[model samples]
Target: MTATRPLLDPAAARRRYVRVCVLFWLPLGLTIAPLVLLLTQRGLGLAAVAGLTAVHSLTAAALELPTGGLSDVLGRRAVLAAAGLLNLAALTLLALGTTPWPLALGMALMGAGRALSSGPAEAWYVDTVQVHGGPGADLRTGLARGSSATSAALAAGTLLGGALPWLLRLGPDLGAATSGRVLPLSVPLLLGAAVYVAFVLHALTALPEPPRPPATLRGVLRGVPGTVLDGLRLGGRDAVVRRVLLSAAAAGGALAALELLTPGRAAALTGASESGAVLFAGLACAGFVCAGLGSHLAPLTARVAGSGERAVLLALGAGACGLLLLGAAPTATGRFSVLLAATGYGLVYLGLGAAGPNQNDALHHRVSGAVRATALSVQSLALQLAGALAGLAVGLLPPGRLPWLLGGAALLSAALLWCRRAGHLAPPDVSSPAEAVRPGVRTDAGEGQRLL
Candidate 1:
């Protein structure tokens, strides 16, 4: 008789998840600081850059659900590896291409990669932990650690990405060899592509899942849409899930407003766009650091609040208060305004960071492993779509406290959604017979009914 491979313990699985999370996010971070500057250096105008960004957003939004469903049908390892490969190609094209078409294609590919990666890793982590520790696994600690790793990777990558070009210029003119086509700004993107190679390797080798039934093309085509439909129906059927989706949208809107308004505020304060850009970059790094700190503190927050539901409510309320403070910042006199704005900025990220793991822990408990990735994809899509709308509205609104106030109000309303006890919500229906009867599995029908 053939022996089966041993399943990983929850502790080992958590460490692996955190490592993969860092690897996955760090590459994207490496490109974030230098992408815009690289495009402009390659001769694209600001208008063109904006259009390309929109293309990325639209492509990701369009593909998010489909890719997530594909992950469900095809398995997490395959989809994640594919995403890494696509990102590698996208980064290469972005680094090398000077023309509009190549750049646009690169952005589209990047968006596709983003959609493909949205939820598989987290889903894999949850599934693995549950398999080892039963349905009552300590998911929040692992989730919090993963979140913290992501933020730390982004913060490190952003600083390294921003500093690489300047450091290169201090040494030698490497761009001369490529006749200025390979500008210093493009170096970060090239390095990002290299990172993706490692990411792909890690995904394929490290993330082993239980054997899925052999999937043919016809099977995949049929399965993906069904899974996607099931995920869409979840929000309508589950009250807790519905609330989570709404809260994600509100958070996205608040973030959109903050990102749209902050740079201009910084520029107005500094009297030069260039200096303001520098300050904004620094502030972005600080925000990520604050987010990491909050994520690290997530378990303690839950302990203090007495439950994950109350923790989310408190954290989001804090975020809403941060937005209100930002709105009030404009009214403050002199240097006090700067101090107030900075404090609010940190608070916004910190609150969001603390809320994310707790919110996701609730989500995982309420979802079956079969549709877990798809549910996460739905959450991501809600955030992206709401952010797009909020960005448009904030852009159109006249410069004042109205935009910030609106964001705060939306977040506050979302916070209030969690004010009621979890027992009041209806339990989610079981997704499948396999999930319902699986050994050591706790279906949402039992625990989800008790905890929101």
Candidate 2:
């Protein structure tokens, strides 16, 4: 038998993983602040923009499972590289495309890239850690650090992305030169594309996995569907997994309410759409900064709460309170209302950031490495689907506190899921060093190995 290659030391692996996380997320941050503004500048109406955003969400939701399965079957590095290439194309199209069709196509491609990239990097990190330190490895610290890096990247990108166009407009003829074919707003997207190139290179070179049996095309085609199905069934089979999925959906609903309604509130406060956009961008940047701080504090949160489950419960409860505060913001008048809104927004993000690492750490303890990426995809899918539903519902409701209240209610319910502990929440044994270290090996034989 061929000897298995030794894995990187845990500390070295973690540093590389954190670096990759920043690279993967920074480009996304660069585009987030300017994407809608750029699209509208190209003559797209609000409805058209909404349609385009829906296309991205639906495409990602549809592809999430299959792409995750592909990662499980093929490998993380290859899948991540593919996502980068697709995102590069997507960003290019968005930056330069003038017509609705091209832009729509770009959105679809971006969604596909989002789905493909979602889980693989985190899965790779967890697998590497467990292989080095056993199934009981200290995963929260690394996970929290990665989450912090992601938020920091996003915060920096949002500031840079929002400022680049304004800076371009200041120079004589600079706006005319860049804004004629490619608007100054599109510069961020172009920069994001360049970043994707770096992301692709780094993903290829930096993330190394243990050798697997050479996969034939037929094997991959056959394996992916099975893996996806197994992932889907995981929620039903495991109590802890079900709780995680449900909580993800609830969190999604809360976030959807915020994203859908917050801009209008900002506009209401500022009394102008343009200024509102600027204010929203600043708020968004601040939110990310708060989230990064929260993520950095996650390990400490877990330590204080006594268990991952308790930490998640407390964190999500805080998020629910934030949403409620937002719901109450409109009831106040003048600067007080703005203050309420801002505080609530920061709290919501902070709580969510803190909750995420603890929740995932609990999740990682329950599932095997073989299906790790697929599991994360399922969690993401739940969030996307629930957010879509929540957006629709919030849109139909009478304006004011109702929408925010609905989100607050959803988050509170999710937080309540962890109020009581179950026996199944305990971590499974993988004390055998070889078994714990083996990537892609099925650990749930008694549950039926036939699934693999």
Candidate 3:
């Protein structure tokens, strides 16, 4: 006789949640400090980098829904394993390849891995929690913990990744001998690949997929398309989900604008290529730390503002102000102005971080487990699609005007979150009221569901 799986206890759920957060983010974070500088160091131009980024986003956008449905049908654990394998290949190519085409190929692989990984881990967490703790299980705290863990991992990995190249440079002979062609910059990506290897092994052993009908190729093909259609329909039928997705797209545009502009700005401020890379790395680390702080404070922000929608609006407003400050910094002449720009950078991450868990919490309440991963993938697709457009457009604009344009777009996004009348529309088409409203708690549609 086969042994039965145990129901997920609170302690077991917490361990899995933290595992998913660390494994998913740590590999990506390891590359953040060196990625752009490494490309430029390999003779890629600004336009080329923009093109590569757009390609990555487009690739991820194309695969998002299909991969989500694959996870929904096949299994989250299987899909996550595939993602890890792909990352191993992608990161190897990225670390070793020198030319643009080679790097582009690596980017393509990375995008596919990203799409596969996006929702499966989170879906697993939600499903496992609901199975043990019931549909009315408190998700905001768990989601926040996952979000904060991701940010914290990024912060620590970025700090370490940034400092490694500098330290390696100090011992030039040994560094060249060990790292070969790509030198200090490529070291982090190589290390990231090793992390992916470990991530795959850990995921295979640690995560237990919920039992479903046995998966067949025919089932996957038939089931996935139907799942995609249902997920798309859900977005159309629900006004809140539609608004949340649009807001995600706008946030994507803002993020693209920042990622494109900021490193170049850092390079200008520091006046040395190597020094700039290190400085940008440090700043990126600081930004991620600030983001973690924002996520940790999200529930408090919601409670204080009286609604998730209002909190989202307030956070976006802060982001817009930060962008405006960044835009203004160039006109001023002082080291203090540079410091102001840095502060603005941190603020943007803070605002974006605060908005994420709130938006996701709203989305989770509006949907059912049957299409959970697909729905999350739809949200991710919106972000990637807008980011692809923003990457191309932001690269074309003069640096001075970029932040203002992005800030305006963010302001418009915040406007969409405003609901004139706070009332219910019969709690959507969710399977149970507990799915939309937390157990015994009553919530208004416009204000969003209260999780805390």
Candidate 4:
């Protein structure tokens, strides 16, 4: 008989949560500030850069379901470690490559890594806690902490990545000696690769997977595809899951527009690439800090609003308002324009941060351990799909119109939440043909039907 694994207690859950936060977020944050700017600096145009980003999203979208299913079938630790390895290789390529095709290739690899890492850690945490504390385990507190930690990591990494290139300039002049071979902007990406190596090592050493049937190559091949199909059916058939997925897609569009437009705006406002990098970095840091604060406030927001759905509506509404402000900021003069842009940017992050845990909590309530990671992947696929479309659209449009378009979409997304409130909600239908074959281990309908 297979040996039963020991259950994870609260303290162990907390430890796993922290590890997930650090491993998943810190490396990504380290490269965010300079990623677009570095591409532009390396001679790609704005449209090309956007296309590269779309490629990343496309790659991630393609792999999201399969990778998630792989985690469910095999184990979270193994998949997470594999993601770290892919990321390390991708980061190295990003730092060293000098051409557009090479850069695009790196981004594609990074996307695969992203898809793999997306849900496994959180799945692991939820599975552990459920095994120990049962279905009623408090998830919001841990999820909130994880979200806040992610934001904090982004904040620190943005600040550091933004300043590192400028800081490197302070050292002895390498431009002349190296014949302009050493680009300061590439330093952070290389550093990020080192961090990725560390994360992989840490994941291997620290993350413990609950014992299950040892997965064979054949089993993995057969099981993963089946799990992916089941996950897709659940997402399509379940009302709450469907709503959350839609919300994620809307968020992706909003974020894609912001990311595509903001760096260029900062560069234009600052009037130089180096100064633009610094300006964008500082603004990104501030935005991430605001996001952390918003995540910290998620539970409180839910409490205040009397329901999670209402809180999502409020947060999305705030985000829409911020995007509208951003759309109008360019019309203003001097310092006011800068201030408005910063405020709008911060508010957008804040709203998204607040919405994240709430939506994930709702998702968690509907999915069981068997398909949890797969469900999260389905959500991620939606986000990446929307982001890819938004990136392509924003790339083709004039920068001035991008924010307005995204703001309208955000409003439409918020409007969706209003259509279903209070008692109108129903438990997910697990009786569908596909789900009946692989029924969810947990029936969350009892708590899921509750107001908040």
Candidate 5:
């Protein structure tokens, strides 16, 4: 039998939350890519950026199932501390090395750090928020807050990436060599290393970790397969989880394709002129700002989505339409298509951020620590795998031809989510409205008679 975890102390939750935002993730956004670009002088070229992203996603995919299990057995706070140290090591490497091999090594290490940090933080938040409200309506609200923090970090990081080097005049004056300007690239990583060290300290003394058995080599190997199996089982048994994962895979796949081919797509839209690249970058930046703003409005969008499942379905549906629009776009229509796609992306994230907690809280009600961690990792792995495949497919076709493929993928994603809701629209939990743990806990989906 699966026993639910108790809600933790609220004040502790707030401390951890604030620490994660300012210390860990924000610094990450500020650190890695821009500095690396300075060393490589690549200026957002496809191979360099895409390779970094692909390696990161692949590492996350490879580790997702096992890392979650590791957290389960070792404790979330310990793993997070280890992760902070690893992040420091990664940035340190980037500061000193510029070759593909060293940078690749650094990027891979960074991805490993991401694997360690991402899900655990969400798990921590879920555990913490459940304390005050019994995972009540506040669960979704908490996720919204997290999403807001992330968006804010992203916005700030993007600006810093553009501003930091020029602010220091570290560029051309640094004396460019055959390998480009090394000094400009070195600064961000060194600064980030210090920040990561702070994160390590915070994780150690500030965060509360539960007691667990000493980690064993044998247990880690045994736990991997077991945890993965548990995750598969949960998805197989639960219609909603299954839908979310499938939708995740499809959306992730499309997003991966977008990441790979967006430049080319933008160029094609803008008539492939000398200014096309700048236009594309600016336009995409604008779209990102819109997404950050959307995070602020997630509560309102949640209401618009009606119920959690419906919100997910609507997000998926909009993405499908956006994809088709891109595929069908012409000279005049392409601009409109990109705009729609951006809108779709922002709206979907809003729904996910708002409804994600509800789903997570439901899972907490359904399983134990190790199993819950494993389940979340399974979703992450599916997304990574989908993204990996989409990225690879980018090269199989001509650079400009990726729009249609993304469209088809989006359609498939929408259909899958719709099917998940068809089977089990779980009723809201009346017994513990405070800890609503049905399929989706936020909405008042009332009654045993919600009979699908």
Candidate 6:
């Protein structure tokens, strides 16, 4: 039997890979996300959170294709730096805003940072690995490691967000508080800035840079429309791409719905008191920690399931079940039972996160650098679109309907996964059709022929 090739230069791949991974996740975890909506000024009402998320998602969607192209044209290092700056600005805005309009704007700006950061980090890692080593290789090591780092950051961030609100670490409540001790809103926000700064400094010092010529302002603007269209076309044509997009959309939708609704769900599930606050914080940390674990375990789970598509379906199914349990957890055993809800949320996220990058890696083997960015951009578009619509829908629903709304999103996510392009598997190497379906594939049908 032939031993498979290494994914990239394992050592450089490991170092640069870990750096980029942490850079992408650390600041993101500390700022602009779960805390912004869930533990916001009003205790994260469903409609309010959903509305803010929708706006944030829309901003992300707006930048998805553009940022992907920027990575291709400008190089990943620059994009990563830009992303960090955008995040710092966004966190500042989010922290300062008390009302909806400013909050929405803050969310939107944060989403732009999210959009710019998304594909570039992985693309850089993959490109670095290829230059140092060879091609058509095993990517799971780097991918899994990166994912593990991200999960770690997320786990840490979840704990921080939960405790930061209640901690009396700050000097005094300038604005005043109900209790003698006070945790100002600026504390978490500033912490987020600190994390972003750390990530930026790390990136500059640790990661390797390659040659990249800058593009003119006119050239960049002209390329945007074509970039968006071409990416959509490429993704649409590829079987693996199709399945990845669906899986990503489903996962994105489910995640958006869960984050938007869960704070209120926890508040309602647990009574509103100091003890209740502790419980809610504990549950929030538990949910994210479990989610991170699910992300780390995704490769194994996908292997068992036989493909990314099936894995996504399984994850979405788990999420759907969790939503139901969360919705009904008002009984004697109800509060204890909602742990299942957190578990399902994590599993679904795992599926979504794993599928897209794996599929993009495969497609990169087929396409050249110029177009590769576009293909990945298309994947970003699909995920963002799904999240945006789901966020809007959840916000539009009446205040108390979040659980059902989340359940509906989970079902929709399942539907999208089930509709994956299952016929495109070509059984690379010696793998069987059954195996291909588990991993999912595109039969040169998309690119007309697989390239050397």
Please tell me which predicted candidate would have the highest TM-score against the true structure.
1
lDDT of 6 by residue, 225-323 (tens): 665565666554555556556656666676667766766665555655555455555665556555555556556756887654465566556656555
Candidate 5, residues 1-452, lDDT tens digits: the string is 01233334765675566567667766676663465355446344666766776776678777787787777666677778888888898887776664667767887888888777766766666655544555232455555566667666665665565556656674455434534435654666677788888888877666554445566879777766766666667666656566657766786676666555556656656676545665554544554455455545555554686555555555455555555555555434355666755555444344444434434433454444555566677777877887777767766777443555564566556545553443323334423322222343323345322211
The list of candidate 5 runs beyond 4 A from truth reads: 1-8, 11-15, 31-36, 42-55, 131-137, 170-172, 175-182, 213-225, 269-277, 280-284, 332-366, 398-402, 408-412, 419-452
Total backbone collisions for each predicted model: 0, 0, 0, 0, 1, 3
Minimal lDDT window, size 10, model 6: 429-438
TM-score of each: 0.94, 0.92, 0.87, 0.87, 0.78, 0.74
* Candidate 1 lDDT by residue in tens digits, 1-452: 01145556788888888888888889888887899999998889999999999989999999999999999888888999999998899999999898999999999999999999999999888888887766556789999999999999999989999999989888778778888778888888889899888888888877777777889999999999988897888777666778889999999999999899988878877778998899899888898898898889898998999888898899899899999999988643369888999899998999899988988887877777788899899999999999999999999999899999999998999889989755532322334613411212233655433352
lDDT, candidate 2, residue 294? 87
Q: Cα lDDT of all candidates, in order?
A: 0.85, 0.85, 0.76, 0.78, 0.59, 0.60
> Model 1 — which ten-residue stretch has the worst lDDT?
433-442
The residue-level lDDT of candidate 2 at 9 comes to 81
Q: TM-score for candidate 1, please give it.
A: 0.94
Please report how far candidate 3 places residue 256 from its true position, in Å. 1.5
Per-residue lDDT value at 149 in model 1: 96
* Between candidates 1 and 5, the TM-score winner: 1
Q: What local lDDT score does residue 192 receive in model 5, on the 0 to 100 scale? A: 76
Worst 10 residues of 5 by lDDT: 433-442
Colliding residue pairs in candidate 6: 306-438, 307-438, 307-439
Clashing pairs in 1: none
Clash number for candidate 4: 0
lDDT tens per residue, model 2, 20-54: 88887898899988898899989999999999998
Off by over 4 Å in 4: 1-5, 36-54, 98-104, 172-182, 267-277, 396-406, 422-452
